[model samples]
Target: SAEGEELLRKLPGYLAQPGVTALVFNFVDQLIHGRSEHAILHEVARDASALRSLTRTWFEESALMRALREAERRSVPVLLTTDHGSIHCNTPATVFAKRDATANLRYKFGEDLRAERPDTALLVDDLPSWGLPQMHLGVRLLLALSDHFFVYPTKLREYQGRYRGAFLHGGVTPEEMIVPVALLTPRSAG
Candidate 1:
């Protein structure tokens, strides 16, 4: 809780130290809150405009922004990226099972389950080719769905409730897999 802020305050000193050549900021799942996770998935699935706003808000006020600013002040080389992206799920294909059911908009899980068109959704069955640059794909997919930070389609309702409404980002897609890396340094040095 408070430790996050405390740690953030000390980051500048940590980066300013000598011998710290490169600083890589990995901000994937932390960008989205637990309550608004599914919102992104719904928005991405049907609305392009919403996605743009979501993306802007994510980069602007997220932890990534805090770290980026600190790194820039210290003139440290920074690379920003993710593991994967997620797809919005509208059609809730029936997944058969005995236990509780998860509430992820992009993906779901249970004991014994099946989907009419599993291919349309990004699941374990489509990891090889669909999952590329592992990191980016993971982040994008998770952020698009629900939060809970990193909740795979394993546990049923418990995890679902924890993540439902939050934004997530892992999975295999262009939005999640293909991320840009920007290098920021002092103007004088540049």
Candidate 2:
């Protein structure tokens, strides 16, 4: 964190003078965006061990973590959580829906939904029973299961080739449904 040491030294000054001290870091967003925009997801998906190492390294080396260490030095408490989890999708299933149907690979909410691989998706008339309050007539919910996710019938091959090894979320897999909660206290806490 030598690169961040200079910035760390300056943080206290800003915090001391600030009327309202607030800091927001988008470190996780940058990683997720890197997965989507870059080929990092595909590169890592096939190698689970490599992916794990990469993630651990990224978190340890991140400036955000450096900042956290600086805060810890000043006896600050930190709460961290994620909105959702992601899965390395393996199962492929094509779902039938209208052209204007919701364009989410993890789930689909549309009318007359049909899946080539029926077991891969959970098709319900509405989303209320699934913990979502929103409901509508003729609107159905199809949540993908396990490593399964939705793919369009048209250009299916192209889509699959592009997304087969990509990590994605918003489905019903355990990885997608479960979230982690972390409360970090200073190591020197008495």
Candidate 3:
């Protein structure tokens, strides 16, 4: 713990670097690993209240508070945002795709991607129209809808056992699509 605190103490200096237009720190790993797994396996609450409690503890214990304190002391502006949010996916939708298809639990993009349960996924054949760059011809995107994750029939049971109730993004659900963005001005600057 002392080592961790020592590492975090350097955050202020890192943020104060000269000519640095912006600096970013990624704490998503802390959010992702073991959060849903523990919640699902231990039958803890998986609702927003639980998330708020967990994140509250994390912010208090982690470097976020220190970062905020440094920013305020230096009168720096802070921008908080997430590329996407995650959802607790319960259902596994069987999908068939080429061997080289990208293997994300929540979505897949490749040629000839098809879900056995069509209702569980939203098929987007027009990648360009969706603001996704077309890597090649026939590069369709399949986004698992609601709380479903794409799984291969060959390893359906294994995937279900491992990923059931896991929090994942890259889907077509509101939880994944609607993310938060906040611009914070330090009180001294404000």
Candidate 4:
């Protein structure tokens, strides 16, 4: 982590060097910690506000910010984008499977699958029209949820307690998918 931070710190210098044309800042789904469900639900949910707080803090302190600031100072162009988004699951969708099943709130993987709500965009059963090749349910759910994922009720308390103080974004909902793209140029020194 320290090394990561150090690398981040050097980003500004890296971009400031020369021959760099454009920089794209794509803060994708749960830009903070989508990799860890437990971390997303537990640590980030503890806070009352949205998880973007953590991202804000990162931008303030991380090398990414430093790089962007340098680019701004130099009058370089920057573009920000996200491939998809995520959602916080307030309603639990029960997925039944045998023991030794892999469990993820956003999606699940197992045999003999069943869900509490049939409305779920089943990957194996649905989404072929979207041109995505057939994959496991988890992968399908992941794609379908694109900016709107699941949040289980079983971990609601834990999520409320732990993730109360972080930033997260993903889900089909507007908040996650509908982000802004900005172009910044340095103010004239005149």
- Indicate which candidate wins on TM-score: 3
Q: Which candidate leads the pack in lDDT? A: 3
Worst 10 residues of 1 by lDDT: 140-149
Residue-level lDDT of model 3, residues 1-190, one tens digit each, is: 5654775678677767765445444455455646556656235446556666766776787666776777778988888777788888889999999886898988898888999989999999988888888788877888999999889999999989888867788898998889898988987886
Task: Compute the lDDT of residue 173 as modeled in candidate 4.
Answer: 55
For each candidate in turn, give its C-alpha RMSD to the true structure in angstroms.
Answer: 8.5, 4.0, 3.0, 5.9
Which 10 consecutive residues of model 4 have the lowest summed lDDT?
140-149
**lDDT, model 1, position 155:** 47
Over 28-88, each residue of candidate 2 has an lDDT whose tens digit, in order, gives 4455545655775546635556666777788788767877787688766667777788787
Cα lDDT tens digits, model 4, 1-190, are 4654676566667666777544445443445464344654445544435455756765687656776666677666666555555554444344554544455544544455555555653444454666656665543333224222333455656655444333344334565567667656567532
Clash number for every model? 36, 0, 0, 29
Off by over 4 Å in 2: 1-33, 44-46
Candidate 1 per-residue lDDT, tens place, 1-190, comes to 3554676777877777777444334333443432254545554523445655766776687555777777777667765444455433222233333344354444444433344344534344233455534432322222222222223345445555544443344434565467766556656557
Alpha-carbon lDDT, every model: 0.47, 0.73, 0.78, 0.51
Error of 1 at 55 (Å): 5.5
